[model samples]
Target: IPHELYEAADVEGAGPFRKWLHITIPLLKPTTLYLMVIYTIAGFQIFERVYIMTAGGPINATTTIVQLIYQTGFSDFNYGRASAEALILFAIIASFSFVQFRFLSTDVEY
Candidate 1:
């Protein structure tokens, strides 16, 4: 965000709240969008932390999709099921990315 925009807002008697709401928030939309997409992808790919921490837990409570995929493909020798799970994971992540972009994307110009 440019200092000049805030200066103009001040000249127009915009209060701090107004400036933050109208200016700061709008300016941050692109950054927020990027972060949301990246974090969503990262979240869907979670495996190591859960595997190392619990290995799907004392009663299989902490299992993530990625860890399940690993167990299905390698441990159980169920490649077909693991492949299907991977495809489902891909579809889910794609749908989430699409929804996030559809809602949050804007023609932001800095």
Candidate 2:
């Protein structure tokens, strides 16, 4: 799909921005939305990478919500707050997944 679009755009001398807006983006919406959800969940759970790379330092530049939960629960011994944060995260993920599934599962009748 992308290759065909790119070829057509190239033949028409379309610029990259025009090609993306007119061809690539429309064709890639489904894949992009799925990947966006996956990346958002991954970002929410970012811990080890930040720990190993930044130690959540530089005034918490790399501090993630998951890292904060771990620090609160284990380091500060605040299990209740950590649990609340976890529940919030779960609710966000569940809502996104439900919406994505509902939209993707619909038939696009031509």
Candidate 3:
């Protein structure tokens, strides 16, 4: 989308940076914000990378909230706390998604 906008701007004699600031960035805000949320959630739930590389070692340097829940539930045999934490995480994600959708949705103008 940004690339298309930039190409159109270029045909109109706009500079690259100007095209980005004037045409690309504004159009990309919603996409950028959505991607940011997705990437942040993915980072928060990161496990395989930590497990394969660090195993949450070095004093839990790579231990994310999801990994902590997993350790508590499976390794330490504590299901109740883990379930509570999981529900909290789900609620946070749901709320964020709802807010993002509400803010990013476009209303058709006749």
Candidate 4:
């Protein structure tokens, strides 16, 4: 954000909260959208941390879809179910990514 915008807002009598809400947030939309999309994809792919940390945390409290797929395929030897689960996870991640890009990809001019 430009310093001049905040100065102009100050000249216009906009208080700190109003200036932040109206100016700062709007200007940061693109960055916010990018972070949201990236974090969402990262969240869906979480596995190693849980696997190495608590290994699904007592009673599977920390079990993620990817970890479940791993257990299903490697531990239980259920390749068919694991394959289906992997496909479903892929579809879910793809849909979420598509929706995020479609809805939040506005032409933001600073």
lDDT of 3 by residue, 11-72 (tens): 89998789778766667776777796797578667788778898788999878788888988
The clash count of every prediction, one per candidate, is: 0, 0, 0, 0
Q: Could you tell me how far off, in angstroms, the CA of residue 67 lies in candidate 2 after the best superposition?
A: 0.4
lDDT of 4 by residue, 51-76 (tens): 99999999999999999999999999
Candidate 2 residue-wise lDDT, 1-110, digit = tens: 64776887899999999987877666666777788778878877878988989878899987888888888899999999999999998998889878876766433221
Runs in model 2 lying further than 4 Å from the true structure: 1-37, 107-110
Show the lowest summed lDDT stretch of 10 residues, model 4: 101-110
**TM-score, candidate number 2:** 0.60
Local distance difference test values of all predictions, in order: 0.96, 0.80, 0.77, 0.93
Evaluate model 1: give its TM-score: 0.95
Give the C-alpha lDDT of model 1.
Answer: 0.96
lDDT of 3 at 105: 54
lDDT tens string, model 1, 1-110?
A: 99999999999999999999999998999999999999999999999988988999988999999999999999999999999999999999999999999999988776
The collision pairs in model 2 are none
> What are the clashing pairs of model 4?
none
Span of ten consecutive residues with least summed lDDT in model 1 = 101-110
TM-score of each: 0.95, 0.60, 0.65, 0.77
lDDT winner = 1
Clashes of 1: 0
Root-mean-square deviation (CA) per prediction: 0.9, 5.0, 4.0, 2.3
